[model samples]
Target: MNTQMTYTAFLDEQCLASGPLVDVATAIQQHANQSNATVLIFNDQTGKQIDLDISGSKQDIQQRYAEHPETVKKVGRPKLGVISREITLQQRHWDWLDQQSSSASAVIRKLIDKELNDPNSESNKMLAKQATDRFMSAMLGNMPNYEEATRALYQGNKEVFLDLIRDYPKDIYQHILKLSAYAF
Candidate 1:
């Protein structure tokens, strides 16, 4: 099943809401309306905070979404903001790329965009693993079985990794799960 991007909103150290990204604005607004609290929205995949521009009216929001510029490349001269760059590759690499694709640049760009756009790709899984490591180090370094958990995470042993982190604090464990959700 396909899942929409999930966001978690926090008020101080307490979790206010965790749901689809589109619902975060309503979550934040509800939290603010109920209590004098400011919300911080975080992407569940990367654990990075996102700032929402909630000052605009409904029409302004609609206009912005309607006029959103496309970033993906089309079958023509690249996007409006695309800049040409000079890249030097080894002769063999250039020859190989030329044999595989119409143009070396296009092949390289396609490879990059493929990795960037697919969260389930191997490159992205590696990134999620790295994020899990960072989070584990910060929050679980002093906990038991840290080394074992790290090993299991890197080795892609899901059962062992889960078992190793089973005794961790609930919030930290949940955050770790969120961070490593895409790693496998």
Candidate 2:
């Protein structure tokens, strides 16, 4: 199964359809044909609006995929583009890391990977909030209760945010929920 993430499509500020990412372009096209509406596709995970060109024929798409053969490498360890960087650390922290592993570099890399995978990490939460803020600014800046919604979003008040966006178009409201899902 191709377990791609879901995406929501907005046509003329209303939710037209939402489904697997691959089908979003087709949905947008269909909605546009019916009403001549502007289409925007928002990724559910990242809260970023995506631009897709569904204008090419099947053969063209196939040819394009064929040209980018690196995308289909066999399942195994991929190439690591490692670069060296100087990191200054406190003596106690460096000592602790040295006690944990053979090499300080390995410990540092492991720590970075762990933090990156931790959704509840402070850095990750901040990133999620920033993404939510950007999405709100782009999609709801001119809405009926923009300031209150933005305040609620920053304060991590889901109920207030939901109530504020109650009158928004379905797609916008749902997209906000998806974007701020990690905020609280």
Q: Estimated TM-score per prediction?
A: 0.60, 0.68
TM-score of 1: 0.60
Model 2 reaches what TM-score against the true structure? 0.68
Report the C-alpha lDDT of model 1 over 1-184, residue by residue, as the tens digit: 1234677766654567777754666656655666876777776656566786554554543444333567787655665545677789899988899798367777888888777778788878887888788656744577899999999998999999999998887766787888888787
Query: Candidate 1: how many backbone clashes?
Result: 0
Residue pairs with clashing backbones, model 1? none
Which residues of candidate 2, in runs, are more than 4 Å off? 1-6, 16-21, 29-36, 58-93, 102-106
* Highest-lDDT candidate: 1
Give the least accurate 10-residue stretch of model 1, judged by summed lDDT.
Answer: 58-67
* Cα lDDT tens digits for candidate 2, 39-74: 777766666788866566545434542323254454
What shift in Å separates residue 57 of candidate 1 from its native position after superposition? 5.3
Indicate which candidate wins on TM-score. 2
